[model samples]
Target: MAGRILVLNTGSSSIKYELVDVTTRDRPARGLVERIGEDMGRLTHRAGDGPPYTRERPVPGHGEGLEAMMEAFAAAGPELAPVAVGHRVVHGGTRFTEPVLVDDEVIAAIEELAPLAPLHNPVNLTGIEVARKAFPGVPQVAVFDTAFHRTLPPEAYTYAVPREWGVRRFGFHGTSCAYVSRRAAALLGRDLAELNLIVLHLGNGASATAIAGGRSIDTSMGMTPLEGLVMGTRSGDVDPALAGYLARVDGLDAQQVEHALTHRGGLLALTGTRDMREVRARDDDTACLALDIYTRRIRKYVGAYYALLGRVGAIVFTGGVGEHDAATRAASLARLERLGITVDPALNQMDTTGERAISPSSAEVPVLVIPTDEEWEIARQTHALIS
Candidate 1:
C-alpha cells in the first residue's frame, strides 16, 4: 500500500499520468501527452522540478502515447516502476461503486457502459488495455468518477421520464468530490459523517454536489456530464425539447444538436471564447453578460443545494476556477448574507492558495477553497485495492 502507483487519465486527445508515491502523498513524476493521433504532438515529463523533459513529433495513437511516456520516464529521472496502475474511467453507471481491478470482464463491463460516457469510457478503456500490455503482470484498477455518487438517494437519482429508457441522474466529478469533501472535513476539524457540504467543482467540466454525512445526496450533473454547470465547451441544462425543436426548424438532427451543445455552447457560444480567464480579461458587454450568466447559474444551484441540505456546515469550492478565481468565488455567492454565508473581501481576493476559508469569520456557513487532487485519490485507491 505504500508503494508507487501510476495514475492515468486518458482524454479523447490527451493522456495525463502521474507516478505517485502514496506513502508520502507526493508525486514522484507526472507528464502529459497532447494532440494524440494528430499530425504532430507534444509530450511533457516532469520529474524533479528542474525542467520538464519535452518531446514533439507525430504520435499516432494512445499506444504510441503510452510508449512516449515510458521513453520520457526513461530519459528523465525517477524510473517508472509502479505496483499498480490506476485509470480514471469516467462512468461506472450503477454497477461499480468503488475502484476495481481491471480484468477481461471488467473491460467488457466498461465497454458496455460506453453509451453512458461515449467520449470518456472508450479512451479510458484504451488506456487500460495499453497499460495491461505494457505492464504485463501489474494490476490495473479502474477508479470511476461516478463511483462516489452511487450514494445518491432514489428520489434524487430518479427522472420522471419513462422506465424503458433506463436513464437517470448519474453524476460525474464524484472522484474530485470524494477527495475534497473528506479534505474539507479534515480542514474543519470535524467528523466527515457529521458534516453537510456543497462542493462546487469548477473546471472545464464543472459540477455542484450536495454531500451529507460524506455521501453524495444530490449533484448538479444528471445522467451525463453535459447536464451540469455551464462548462468551458458544454452547455449545461438547456430546454429538454431543444433537440426536437432544432430538428423541426433547422433540419438539424438530434445528433447535430447534441454535438453543437456539447462543443459549441456555453462561454464559447456567448462570447466566442471558452476560457473564463479570457472573458474576465475583456471589459466588453459580451464578456460581462457571459460572466453574469455563468455566475447566476452557479448562484441558483447554491440556493437549490442549500435547500436540499437544509442547514449546511460549509460550501466548498474546488477545481481550477473555484480554487483560483476570487471574482468567481465572490460573484457566485453574492447577496447570500441572509443565509449567513458571506466571503470576506480581503480573504476572498488574497493571492494565497491551499485549503482556506474565504467566508467571513462570524459567518454561519463557511466558504472554503480546496484544490482537488483526483490523481492522488485514484492512486490511493489503486494502492489499497492492490494491497
Candidate 2:
C-alpha cells in the first residue's frame, strides 16, 4: 500500500499510464501510447528529469499498446511493480459515487454503462481487462470522473426531459475539480466547507461546476460531456431542435449530428484548429470571432453559475487552457468588475508554474490558476481502496 499505484487512463486512441508513489506523491514513470489502431503510433516514456525514452511503431490495438507500455517500463528503469492499478472510468452513472475495487461484477457493471459513454467506456474496459491480465493478482480500483459530482442536488442534475429517458446532468471533470477545489481552499487559507466556488476546467474537454460547502451543487455538463463549455473539438451547447433542423435541412441523423458536434465542432469548427494557443496566435477575423464566441459562452456560464451560487468565494481555473493561457484568463472574466472579480494584469501575465492568485488581493473573488493533478488523485483513491 505504501509503495506505488499504476494509474491508467485509456482513451479511444491513447493509453496514458503513470507509476505513482502514493506516499511521496511523485510520479516515477509516466508515458502515453498514442494513435492506437493507426499505422503510425508513438510511445513516449519519462522517468525522473532525464529526456523521455520514445518509440515509434504501429500499435494496432490496446493490447499492443499495453505491450508497448510494458516494453517501455522494462527498457526504461523503475522496475514496474505496482501494489495496485487505478483506472480512470469516465462515466459511473448513478450507481457509483465513489471509487470501487474492480471485480467481475464491477467489470460487468462498467460494461453495462458503456452505452452512456460509447466512446470511452469500452476502451476504459479494455484497459481494465489488459491491466487485469498484465498484473494478475494486483488489486485494480476504478476511479470515476462522474463520482465527485454525485453530490449534485436534485434540481441541478434533474432534466425536464421524460424521466423514462433516464437522462440527466452527469458532470465530467470531477477528478480535476476535486483536486483543484481542495487546493483552492488551501491557497485561500479557508476551510473548503465554508467556500462557495465556481470551478472552470478548461482543457480540450471543458466544464464549469458550482461548488458550495465542498459539494457540487450545479454543473455545466448535462447527460453527456457535450453539454458543457466550448471545448477543443466538442460544441458546448446547441439548440435542442438542432438535430431535427439538420435532419430537415441537410438529411442528417441524430447520431450523425451528435458525432459532428462532438468531433468537428468547438474551436476546430470555428477556427479550423483545436489548439487554443494556435487560435490565439492568429490575428485573422475568423480567429478573433472564434475567441469571442468561446469566451462569451464561458462568461454566460460564469454568470449563470454565479446566480446559482449567489455568492462565490473564488473562481478557480484549472486544466490546460485555464492554467497556461493568461490572455484567456483575462478575456473570459473581462467586464466582471461589477461583481468585484478583477484581474491584476501584471500578476495574471506573470509566468509561474504553481498555484497562485491572478486577481488583485483586494478583489471580492480571488481568481486562481490551479494546475489540476488528476493522475495523482486517481492513485490516491486507488491506494485508499486497496489499503
Per candidate, the number of residue pairs that clash is: 0, 0
Q: How well is each residue in 1-387 modelled by candidate 1, as lDDT tens digits?
A: 677899999976789999998888778899999999889999999996769999999989888898899899889978777889999999999899999999999999999998777778998998999899888998999999999999999999999998998899999997799899999999999999999999999987889999999999999998878896888888999999999888899999977887898888988999998888998999999999989989999999999999999999999999889999999999999999898889999999999888899987888999999999888889888888888
How many Å off is the CA of 287 in candidate 2?
Answer: 0.9
TM-score of 1: 0.96
What's model 1's overall lDDT? 0.91
Clashing pairs in 1: none
Model 2 has an lDDT value of 0.91
Q: For candidate 2, lDDT tens digit of each residue in 149-206?
A: 9999888889898889878888888889999999999999999999999999998888
